[model samples]
Target: MASDFDDPGYDYAVSVAGRAVRTMAEQRIPPMPTNFAIWFQYYAGSHNNLRNAIDLLIDHNRPFDVSTNQDLFETCIAPEVSAVVVETSERLQA
Candidate 1:
């Protein structure tokens, strides 16, 4: 029997992460945590709005400047981060 660590899903996730990092380097986006989270979600195809926003920006040839990255993080990743924080706090309190 194969170990859980050998699951194909793990490989897929690694592939997505690699693509995210490569795309970030190509776009000159910083390898900051928030930026990586945003790009990871984009490459994972799990967040449509985030993907659409990024696609629009790329389509328009917009630079991923600090402001643009900040906007993307706020719009795309902050809500998920807030939810995780809230869940963790509740779990700890429980």
Candidate 2:
């Protein structure tokens, strides 16, 4: 059985973050933590569930591409995420 902490994504995330930092340095982008975070989040796209879904597909030997990308977005990603424009709004309302 696979544990959440052992997810292959941790390695992928580290690699991407390192690349982000290096790329910024090479291009002379500001070395601020905020800038690094912005680039990292852009790397993840707007969808919060995207990385997890792709990880699942890759782990199962499923083909992930443009066609399947739309399928996953519509069928899984959109539905799974909350509709809140501001997630904290719920807390404020309560």
RMSD of each: 5.7, 10.5
User: Compared with the true structure, what per-residue lDDT tens digits does model 1 show for residues 1-94?
Assistant: 2221233487897998899999989988889998988887888787789999999999999999999999999998898777777877988999
Model 1, stretches more than 4 Å misplaced?
1-9
Best by TM-score: 1
Q: In order, what lDDT does every prediction score?
A: 0.84, 0.54
Give the TM-score comparing model 1 with the true structure, all chains together: 0.85
lDDT of 2 by residue, 15-34 (tens): 76887687557645576654
Give me the candidate number with maximum lDDT: 1
Scanning candidate 1 in windows of ten residues, the lowest lDDT window is 1-10
Question: Looking at candidate 2, what is the lDDT of residue 27?
Answer: 49
The alpha-carbon deviation from the true structure for residue 87 of candidate 2, after best TM-score superposition, in angstroms, is 0.4
